[model samples]
Target: MKKNKLEVIPLIDDFSQWLAEADKSDNTIKTYRAVLNQFHEWLLSEGMDLNHLKKKDVQQYITYLESQNKSLATVEKAFATISMFARFLKKLDVVQDIKRKQKDKKNQEAPDSLTLDECNHLLAEVKKRRQPS
Candidate 1:
């Protein structure tokens, strides 16, 4: 009888293993997995290999996220997920650390503010709570 050879496993398999061992919340794990799958799909669409990914590739993904009208916080979360995945790959000796570009502030608009009276009332309440008799 001939012995059968096992086929090479995918990077995602390793990622799933690591995610299982990680001490993270269920929501966090789900979000990370979703972001990773998005990255995997983007890689497939672009004919790119996981081991050969570059910072520019990450930038392109960021641009794609922006084009889809994703909020800055959501984009940041996706970037953080990718960064974590990269670290996992590094630990597995699959690839070196690839530095992603800092996000551009062009899409970040200032948040709306409360009225002066509302701010003053909030501050007064805080002061009252902190004051010693």
Candidate 2:
């Protein structure tokens, strides 16, 4: 009997096995698997497949994570998982030149501000604090 093979969307189990063979800790393998599963789901929503992953898709994912207000550490970890998966899929050679970098607040845009009413109330409080007793 022959086992079924999927050309598209590489199996997470296979990747997990590869990671284990590479001496990655069980916790690391589990974390990578979870991250990959999330990426797979995001790809499905975006009408993409892992077999056809591209640099832009990865960037878009990072943007999506940021939009969802995911912590920087979470985003970086996800990127690392994707980078490792790209290396694992060397034959396909997708997601080239995606380098991880230290996140800088100066490079990032300012976060969205509160609504007008909230800002006004905050200003009023600041003004009250400025007054002496």
Candidate 3:
């Protein structure tokens, strides 16, 4: 079947502007643009309009990514990228709340690294460096 073209010229334009104004690093902006472009391609293939996207559509896209054997971390990053796009859309009043599910609480904990003593020592070192001679 011929894929329907989901008009994203305006979105691309707006995203470029937002990206320019954003405080994000160059790598971050590139990742966000890549993720948004992937979503745009999927929408066209599904014959869906950008303005008419639903939460279920996002869920299905996530599932599709999993089926392709993408790593959980990669999938999560894509979700975050898309969430930024959703926020941009909301800012333009093109859509309502389209926030993705939050990361599992179990996964949100910091990895074992610095201990309380280490943290305190690091803070002290920083303060020492800032002290006047």
**What are the per-model C-alpha RMSD values against the true structure?**
8.1, 10.0, 6.9
lDDT per residue (tens digit) for residues 28-90 in model 2: 999998899898878877877676678888988988988898988998999889989888877
Superior by lDDT: candidate 1 or candidate 3: 3
* Per-structure clash totals for the candidates: 0, 0, 0
Instruction: Provide the global lDDT of candidate 3 against the true structure.
Output: 0.71
Residue runs of model 2 more than 4 Å from their true location after superposition? 1-10, 91-102, 105-133
lDDT of each: 0.69, 0.80, 0.71
Model 1 TM-score is 0.59
lDDT of 3 by residue, 74-121 (tens): 788877766677777773232234343445799788999999999999
| TM-score of structure candidate 3 | 0.61
- Which regions of candidate 1 fall more than 4 Å away from where they truly are? 1-9, 91-133
Q: Give the winner by TM-score: 1 or 2.
A: 2
- Best to worst by lDDT, what's the order? 2, 3, 1
In candidate 2, residue 118 scores what lDDT? 97
Estimate TM-scores for all models: 0.59, 0.65, 0.61
* Candidate 1: tens digits of C-alpha lDDT, residues 67-125: 88888787888788877877886742322343334567775878789999999999999
